[model samples]
Target: MVSKPALRTGGYIFKFFFRETKMNISISKKGISALLASVLLTLAAPVTTLANVKNPGLLVHAADDEATTLDPAQVEPGEGGETIILQVYDRLLDIDPYSPNLVPSLATEVPTIANGGISSNGLTYTFKLRQGVSFHDGTAFTADDVKFSWDRAMEMDLPEGNAGALSDVVASTEVVDDFTFKVTLSEPVADFLNSVVVAMVSSVVSQDAVEANGGVEAGSPNEFMAGNMVGTGPYKFLVWNRNENIQLEVNDNYWGENAKLNVRVEIGGDPDVRVLGLRAGEFDTVETDPSFVADLEGADGVTIYTGGLLLEPLHIGFNLNIPEGSLPDGDTIPEDFFHDPRIRQAFNHAFDYEAFLNGPLAGYGAFNPHYTPIGIFGHDESAPVYAKQNYAEAERLFKEAGVWDEGFSVSVITEEGNLFALMCLVLKDSIEKLNPKFRINVLAVAEAVFDDAHAQNPLEYAMWAKNADPAADPNFYMQAYQHPDGEWGEVHGFANGYKDAGKVAELIDAAAVELDTGKRAALYKELNEILYNDPMWLIGAQEGVVMAHRDWLKGFVQNPLWPRPSLKFALFDK
Candidate 1:
């Protein structure tokens, strides 16, 4: 089984110290004396001697752990790996940094119905790669590389990877020539190009590199390519010092103008530490939590970029199949309590949305009722809204479900984070206020333990968040909750015995392949209505993504589709 290299902070420091001093100890007495004299001369050297040396450029602080893998086909999508993958790989098409439209990158131009690149039926897409491009490893990039990269991603079918974005839409690919290829879809899909360009999984990789590195058939978490990279992007993979930092150098052989500065991405999980580091000038830019926004405002030489509503939303999920006493000792819930839709709907109405949204969220988040967030397509503005506090309705639903008299008690599990833990407490308070015997417990566990519990045996009720693709398409956002074969449903829904779970999955499948935009939107809207009524999840609010950077940093574009800013075109003035 493939596994990530363990964090070796102490080992790295020891090796660095030993390597730096090893040569010094080997010198003879006469050579040592000469070196000492040279050192004294350097100490006496003019200040201009050191001042003339060039700066290596920017130092960035990432608000995440070390990446699990760097291979485009195997890396998890979103903030976890996309931030680094964008710097090391180039895709056939890309979203415009300044706009939402698709733009040409490795491909010569954007394919559209009017551009003739897309067939009239929309089932066929043809692309011409930019000529004279070379990978970081010096292999010439061709149509074969594109085919091989996409085929590898689909064949591997890694659930955590971005392969899910295209696995449904793409049927197969045909290499027309060295510089051109065509993608044939099982059916016409309007968002096909957007899906390909916006997803890093579609980034081309060197075919020769894969074969040398055990090939795609070697299975997921490919050990060889995880630590190495062979892509045609502006930056090349240098080294990843686990738990410490990742270093990247500019690719001089790049087809386009390379980044003027090399990047050093340091791993840091504490938002406060990142803020202090940025203020101390140790970091040129950092991803910050919403709580840090107020402190960062008006600081000297600092600029904060706030995003619009995020596509991801935090919600409380129900494990309908949860068994009695499945939770930690001393916390026991009925086995089939959540199987009734009325209980789920009661919990939905019992939430104090206004207090939570305005209090913990600092009024920065908006109430979201549907599985799909507000800004994404297919979101119905006029959809029925859930009341912030409806004790009467909640009581009525509980009674109708035959649980109001006895007043059942259950616990809500969440990972340890200030915001998440606080949300769990707020939910518990709201639900318990309904009846005298009603009780709701809040359980906050360590992130690692929580992840294990969530994967192994999900609690009866839990609060969590989900991320969507850059396209903000409803087809991508809603699939996680509705698709029968989806990772989320398979793990959290089917395992817990959700009622008629396959109904929504059928709707999602139809919307995914539908060619007409209006029809597809209708299908999604209908699906959202069904979920809103059934109340599979107690949908919550969506917080805006906030980031902080030094004022001298320029050209950093914020894309709403992504959780973080894109630094591919970012530069340092000094």
Candidate 2:
């Protein structure tokens, strides 16, 4: 059975107030909203002072409520888990908020070819750990912990975990001393530091704590560490009330900048409820949808901050290897339907990209055809743009593929949500309109079922999103999508049976080890052209991240690499 924190009456009452008054609050008296009035009363109320004395902290309401796990190595990329993991774990190298370069975190400095810490051949890297640092459990951190953490991550071999980024790169780890270690790579990986070592998956864990809980042999979904945490970060885990909230307290012995406020992360999935909580002073900050910005604009004491385009781009992936008889509605799709480049190209041109972006996306997204965000390296601005709807060209390609005569019916699956489900509907409407014979079925499934379907078969089509780390090279995204035996292709079941899979894998391998930046960029550009012409997936819009916070919440910096803002330096002015 999972252990839960003692339910505080004050916390319960505060949550009740937000849940009850959220939708009904009106602005009538002197143009001051009931929510604003409630805020004023709550600030002045004596009960507020007593409540603060009991629990002096900041409450952050997340738009995403579910967290699969908190164990860094086991965590998939998500808003809730990533937000908490950032607070509980420290990486070897930290992403600088203001720049694209990497900075030191657990390590004293970043290793580079220019620095002697990295060998001349670029196959070996030596890291000097920061001395006097300790985990939240009060155990002193050492190089052994570093080696154990990374080795354990690779040994576990989680297909979905971010640690897969280092699968073939890290040959072995050697602990030199109490505060020093060296990582030997199988090949010269130019972006190994940014892509793998600096990734959150490489976060060091307490070897002793892990052993006591369950070592690598304990298997995945590391239940013990998922609910608990022991790391050398700025905050310590207090309690995780699953699907409800996660409470964290400041680590008094933190080696870096200490967190000013104990945090209470209330898990509310509805954006409107989160907005209401922010207005009623129930939360210090809240992650909100871009659609909610118009409603919250000009509200008192609330500032809407927009984090420009996220690293993730919304796209539609084709299941090239769907079994012939596996589709819904008893329809039998040809085995080679998605594998045919003509069909993929035709599907790409069938969507009305601009209409969907301006309408459902609230005019807050831009077209990116390379399956990569605009700001990242190797984006290939010269690649053929596919932003406009082209039904005539689509018809021609369909005819060439010999699927236009009878037309074909296929079910496209998307997770049940306002954005993704709406995207599926739009595609269905647009594709059906192109030809009456063209049948498109949009299936919106629950999050859990949808995740399983996506991982297992993906049926005929799947609409998904991917976030590539901006600080890392574009090879990270390419390896996942273009390479046949790569993480996403082989593990997550996407583009697994493409004819050029082997060739794409070879190109990706070549690009990974290329030391010259220009040569690497050219190789990626060539790969982008191949994928663009063949069209593995239909690239969609780059969505923006919009958030709202109270004016008193300070020092919140948005990093593209993370789904949520970095709260390490954040403080509650109140």
Candidate 3:
């Protein structure tokens, strides 16, 4: 059996400690005796240092990943970039770190139809901006800045950026007054506030700062903004030592509750190193794994923090149209490899779901249906799913697909030395056991290379492994993963593979604009059933979050809805 490593549950382990020593030595005839006496005293007990060297409230965090860019519009959602963005920038609206409820941030209140903040038709939204708020640059926050920031993000719709969150619904953003902002959507979108407004991509940036730096350009990332940050949150950007650590200091000038502790986020990619640091009191917290729970649960001064299962679940995406000349084994596999529904179903049944849930996930996960996981709006516990592997079903499907005797070879890609690669190895082991003719190659590549290839039109690989970005609403999931014209759908050519692509697209579009909660949910539930029959991706288990932190670190709330390392530093105190 191929050994699989634990999931790199990206985390921010804040290790806080400071030591300083001061010694007074007499330069008399007894200099050697005095120095020896002072050294003995220091060894016996603690020595007091100067007031200037006294330790302030500070935390040093280590993580498995680093921020690719600080630009809110450019950063990939749910990545390391978000942890920094939420600390440094404030959105018009915010989600409570402990709950899914929306909270007022830059805006005076969350816009709703009941308060006339949202239009009856739901296309228009008006926000009453907070007064006396200022960006890190000391510029007044106003409706004009709000409009400029939103407009700039929409205009600079870089292909790699998360601008689609805004560009997809917003038709225009208008400033009614210095403190009033209005947004008109092209269509009435259900859960628009939770999914898009509260998202990091919709975060308001300093208009003056951005204009002075690299101005907004369509389809191009602002290099200046990517490296620097200026916002109206509880923390200010102190310094970002690339590939080393990022430091943030408490913003004394913040309009809201001030942050209790200054944060220093270090980039530590190796989980073993992070674990060692946590055990040695070198890290207050670390990006923890389920496997590490056994190691750290009994360690002194450590607390294991576990929260609800994350909405994000890893999936094995099947590409219907593998590009010509890109197949790993062209002689054995065809370009239209996963175009057959039976083949997709066969692969789905071939995976050992229970093993994965208990193995790498440590039984803290659930087998969710495609595109819907626990805590997501559309997720239903009653939904049918592939709960376990059935070799009989796998063999029967292969025979039905007429590939029992002529088994094919194909390569599936994943990031090297990660849980996704391990999942691929699991799939490889199970599928190969069916027949000697069946062959599978797990192609592990660097993350950058994998991402670059994953982003290609009509994905080059026959299959690839990765997780979905967490979303509060079903519309975002349907559009990105289920809709025929959506990101993965268009790229993987699900329109060609799906039996009724037009019908699926229709239902997804209807769900997005559906105002009635019952109707919207019903639409998604229907899609879930339809998709289960015509599977486009293999649903991996959804893992809950578990972090190990120093017992002294209080008020650590892990909200799966927030970005990875799920704690909000402002709410924490040591």
**What overall lDDT goes with each candidate model?**
0.68, 0.70, 0.79
Q: What is the C-alpha RMSD of each candidate to the true structure, in Å?
A: 9.7, 8.2, 8.2
Pairs clashing in candidate 2?
Answer: none
Give the TM-score ranking, best first.
Answer: 3, 2, 1
- Writing each residue's lDDT as its tens digit, candidate 2 over 1-574 gives 1111121221111111111222222222343355556656644554333334222455454444656778878876554676788788888888787656789989999987787789999899999899999998888999999999988888776766767666678888999999989999989997888678767678889998999887775246567987899998888999987656788888889998777787877775655556666665667777665556655666666778775666666777776666546667734456556767788888889887876676655567777756556766777788776788899999999999898889877777877655666566667777888889888777777767776776664344433432333335687778776677765576434454455767777888898899888998888877877777777777667777667776656676666664354444333434
Q: In model 2, which runs have C-alpha deviations exceeding 4 angstroms? A: 1-59, 158-160, 212-222, 330-333, 457-471, 488-502, 563-574
Candidate 3 residue-wise lDDT, 425-455, digit = tens: 7787778886778988988887788989887
**Superposed model 1: Cα runs more than 4 Å off:** 1-56, 158-160, 330-332, 457-471, 494-503, 563-574
Instruction: Tell me, by lDDT, which candidate is best.
Output: 3
Task: Tell me how many clashing residue pairs each candidate has.
Answer: 1, 0, 5
* Candidate 3 lDDT score at position 56: 42
| lDDT score of residue 214 within candidate 1 | 86
Worst 10 residues of 1 by lDDT: 10-19
Q: Estimate the TM-score for candidate 2.
A: 0.85
lDDT of 1 by residue, 1-574 (tens): 1111222221111100100111212224574455445444534544323233223365465544567788788887664566778778888987766656778888999887787888888899999889999998888999999999988988888866778667777888989999988999888776677665568788888999989878876246677877888889888888887766778887888887767778778774555445555554456678765556655666655678775666667676776655455654544456666667788888888888766665555556776655667776677777666747788989999999888787766777776655566566667778777686788777777767666666664444433432333445666656666565675666555434445667877888888777778998888778767777777677656766667876556575666664345445333433
Model 3 Cα displacement at 87 (Å)?
0.4
Candidate 3 local accuracy as lDDT? 0.79
